[model samples]
Target chain A: MPVMDKLKAVSGTAAIVGVAESDQIGRTPDKGPLELHAEAGRNALADAGIDKSEVDGVFTAGYSTYDVAEYLGITPHFTDSTSVGGSSFVIHIAHAIAAIQAGYCEVALITHGQTGRSDRARAGGNPGLPSAQYEVPYGIIGPPVAYSLAANRYMHQYGEDRTREAMANIAVSTRKWANMNEKAFFYDTPMSFDEYHDSRWISWPFHLPDCCLVTDAGAAIVITSAERAKSTRKGAVSILGAAEGHDHGILHQMPDLTRTWGRHSGPQALEMAGVTHDDLDLAMIYDSFTYTVLATLESLGFCGPGDGPDFVADQRTAPGGDFPLNTSGGGLSYTHPGMYGIFTVVEAVRQLRGETGQRQLDDCKLAMAHGTGGLLSSTGTVILGRD
Target chain B: MADGYNKPIPIPQPESDNYWEGTKAGELRLRHCDDCNQAYFYPRNICPECGNNNTSWIVASGNAKIHTFAIVHRPPHPGFMDDIPYVPAIVELEEGPKMATQIVNVEADPSKISIDMAVKVVFESITDEISLPKFEPA
Candidate 1:
């Protein structure tokens, strides 16, 4: 059988049955991360018309004091607390597929929440492993700095004169998409390419407008087999293909700072799903930084590596353009609660289901959702469709 | 002794002891797996490729080429504010492992740093307990 045929055999085998969120998310002084997660989880289950008792698995990313089984008041047959930075949610989807295919669990709930806006100013050392102590002391901190290194290198490798202007175009295009998304944090804040160029530099190549928002919010989704999804309250979004690849953990370990696992993983996912770039109607790429989205587009065969700047030029990524990207404003304009990967899956499913309201595409039958973790350490790509 | 300053230090573990010890001796050491013959840094007990536990610490030549880097104009943390517009780089070491280290002794001008500039290792003592390994133009 051909790859597409093989993929079609597994098509509709697993589906995301429901999705939900806890209110309009942002600087939520009234709530904590756990409360948002729990509320979103409850809402997802309610949307699926299923009770917590039926959930056999719970998957989450990052630190959490509330045990998945304990919070839901049921002992799950399987549990995964895999945290791979912002891309954890995308990885969670692949994990859910494995669990269902292995007969380990039937229904899995994946959720994310954070109080990033209020927590931004608070500074203390991250309490995990001290292996990075040597580098941390010299001031290599956070994703922005790490990604900035890659962005700077790309500019140097490929001429620098118009690079910032090219990047500004990308930010402007995303903002245009956000204007249609009422849920986005910067819905009313439309930005121009010139405005993006004039924005103060956060890290040389990366301007203030190029970075993603640090907003407080929570989102959850329910995944189960196609057989079970048929009985759910919401329509199903099929899992076409999913793949994850890791090159290195630390920024320095990357073979080439300008390139990432997305270059390798994105193509593999498309090949695995038996789909080509031409078949994709829309894309929800993880935009922790504008470079990430640009890199993914190039890696996924949308354009060549250095050609990303040209590919997204002239409002190409905006709605009514050749390729519609991040119709939900992406993390750049949307709420990013640290793990913004989950929202990519959520948004992709929404688009595939034609639930994006004004931001919805006219014919979004097939969609691609890409997520990155660590400092471009790991990448996960999932292709979703409605067949 | 001052606000927003804590003496940063590395706490060594079984997998990374040699790397820390190598720094004290002014040598950069990486772990080479006997099974796969692939050298790696950020010391792992087992080879990431072949999953072999038999590994040995080997001193590197400290020679490298700039693979990619970023010049940070903004400091995300208070500790880094003074070092704005500094270059944070990823260098491909001659020893066959890629390492993340600061590139020093080079003009901050973007025109100067190319994609594959040759570089060598230098050590900077940050605290009494730790000495960081950084790269400079070779």
Candidate 2:
């Protein structure tokens, strides 16, 4: 058997039994980060019909795993606090599968909550940290500044005018989805190409609308062995495959400005799942910035390099298009509370479960959720399916 | 760009002390691995290419090309507010490693700057202890 066949054994062994967000997303000044975690955890447990006491494995990012366990009132036999930026939660699902297979824990809960908007909290680093000393000193902090470097490079490699058009299309199309999603921050407001082009430049190559919203939100996921999932109230979405990787921590060190490790991880995930891009009914690629989606789509082999702008040119990824992407409005128009990875999974699970009210894709069976974190540094790709 | 030195100063680590020292002395230094026959930036003891501990410093030729960059209209640190619309970029050194630095001595405009444009190192003495390595069009 080939190496790819080895992953097939573990495929579909674990399933997501529950997925939920906090009571309120966007902005909630009353809720701290931990409280949002607990609210989402409570809702997810209720969704799974699993008692909080049943969760024996705890996985989270952006905070201490011990704190999450203490707040959730669970004593776990397994815990992983992998903090690879926004992609941590999606990576957690991959970790939960291995832990469950090892008999380390049967029930696992992965959670994320951040007060990015309410607290205005920025990810801190020690004074001696390389990023602080080198990258930050040059004013290359935050998503807009860091991500724009690559966006600029992408425009340089591709055509600048067409690339700008492609980016504007993402903002316009994604907002169209948000218009139908009452929970989306921009649900009431629609964006046009002229509006996106006219938005103020947060950084060159990135307009205000091109950046993700800084919202306060929380999301959670519960995973278990596929056998155990049979008894759950809501049918489980099988974790068909997952892969996580990073090429560099800082934006400058990235081998290619226009490409990411998504090139490697996306193929590995699809191969492990025994599925192809054609098999996916929905794609939940992280839209931290409009350029992120374009780069990721090309890296995932959905389109050829420098062809991203053309691929997304006419709002093809929007609702009522041939390829539906970011059906939950994505971080661009939806709520982005720091890490948007978990929400991608949440939205994918909802679409697979036929729970999305209006923006849902009909007959959505196979979905791929790709998460990009840091300065386009980390990536996690998870392929999911439902019977 | 600003009168006061309000921006952050690079805190030298044991691994990167020599690099900073070289910058202050008006020399851009890189870590060279004899085994791998390659040089890398943000100087550290271990060679990133081959994981070789037997490494030495070599002064860069001060020639590079713009790999990518962003004109930071919004300052991340309030200290950088005065330099609004400044260019922060990753320039690929002639020595083969990329480093984070500011593109100075040029207008911060799309028409003025581009990827693969030649640039050379220039030092800015921000404090008594540190001199930041900035780049300008060659």
Candidate 3:
């Protein structure tokens, strides 16, 4: 069979039965990374009303799946630790669905946790990696530097002044959504265009406001066969479609700075779901930086190249707008525990279940959660719908 | 070189040994595949394009143009503290493959740099065994 046909065969075969975030997400100085994982795993299992013993599969990013499985006291028959940065959780969802169809595992639990702010989880580097040899030696220090390079290319391709305005609009608009979400770290703090424009630069073309916060958090999701989801507590969100891919491992090797792998994955997953762009009620795109959202919008075929600035103008993605996006404040205003892909999935499932109180959309039947990891190197898209 | 010169050093693997030797001799090198008629970067044995093991080393002209750049205001490591605002860029070689390098002998200002600006390679010897490849405005 063709690759697309094989992907479509697994459509709606698995559903997300439960999703939860660790209590006290931001700034958990007391809890370690493993403790956060355990907490989230326990909470998600409860939300699904499924016994811990029923979990036959385990998945996690960052830490080894063996560690998470052992820590959670789960001898899962199937285990995966697909660590491709933040997109791992999103990819795990897709992998879990396929694994269930193959009878490799029935109930799969995916979890993520990091003490990014209080302890700075990701502080070291691997000297053996290609980045260390090539880019790191030339002062390509952190993610902001690599991401700013891409942003600079985008601005050069588009109008600089226009691009800056569009980025500011994203920051302010995402903050508006954050105001409605009480759990958001920036819930009480609102942002303005002036504030975004005036913020000091972390890397040129990227103000502090444009970057994601490095807070601590843990999130988990429970997936099982669609038939088993019928007995779950809440309405199961069907796994309509999903796809994961990458163009390069490092920033400089990217075929195009302004374009991401999402261009391929987004359309592929949407095709498998048999849905059009108009079918989506909300879009949960990763916001490691404001520029990420803009570039992703174009890459996902939501807009054309260089049209992102105009597409997001006038707070189009803000709450109560025509296009509801990042409804959970996103990583920009929400808690970003280093790896934020799980949170995007969590928010998508919540919106599909009408669990979002103030930020909930009316009759939200279908939603899309897109994740980008490692300086736009890795991309994963999951299209979810309510039964 | 300044004292306490703490910076990351490129360790050459077996496949990349020729490329590093070329850099140490102030020559930029790239891997080329005769099977696919293409040149690539980041030293590997197999041709990424054709998966052909029949590949050899070729000397790059060191002439290139800036594809993209970033002015890093915050340094990631203490070694880079002196250069508070540095320009790290990806330059497209005349051979087609791009490389990550620093733009030296220029101010770290957006107005002073741009995309597709022509540049030429310059070697900065950090140690006896390694000479980092850098670029400057043509």
Q: Model 1: how far is B54 from its true place, Å?
A: 6.2
List runs of model 1 lying over 4 Å from the truth.
A1-8, A63-66, A121-134, A161-163, B1-7, B30-40, B44-61, B94-96
lDDT of 3 by residue, A249-336 (tens): 9898888888999999899889999998989999999999999999999999999999999999999999988999999999999989
lDDT of 1 by residue, A1-387 (tens): 225555446655788987877665867888887777877788888878888898888888765424655666757888888888887888788789878988999999887877888677644555345425545655567888788878877787776755665677778888998899888899998887678878887776788888999999988889999888888887678887877778877776667666777876677667767889899998888898887777767776788878888888888889889889888898899778777888888888888888889888987899999988888788888888886
Candidate 2's TM-score: 0.98
Pick out the ten consecutive residues of candidate 1 chain B with the lowest summed lDDT. Answer: B1-10
* Superior by TM-score: candidate 1 or candidate 2: 2
The stretch of ten residues in a row with the least summed lDDT in candidate 2 chain B is B1-10
Error of 3 at A260 (Å): 1.2
Candidate 1: the clashing residue pairs are: A149-B70, A252-B100
Q: What is the interface RMSD of each candidate, in Å?
A: 2.6, 1.1, 1.1
| Candidate 3 ranges beyond 4 A from true positions | A121-123
Measured with C-alpha atoms, the lDDT of residue A256 in candidate 3 is 89
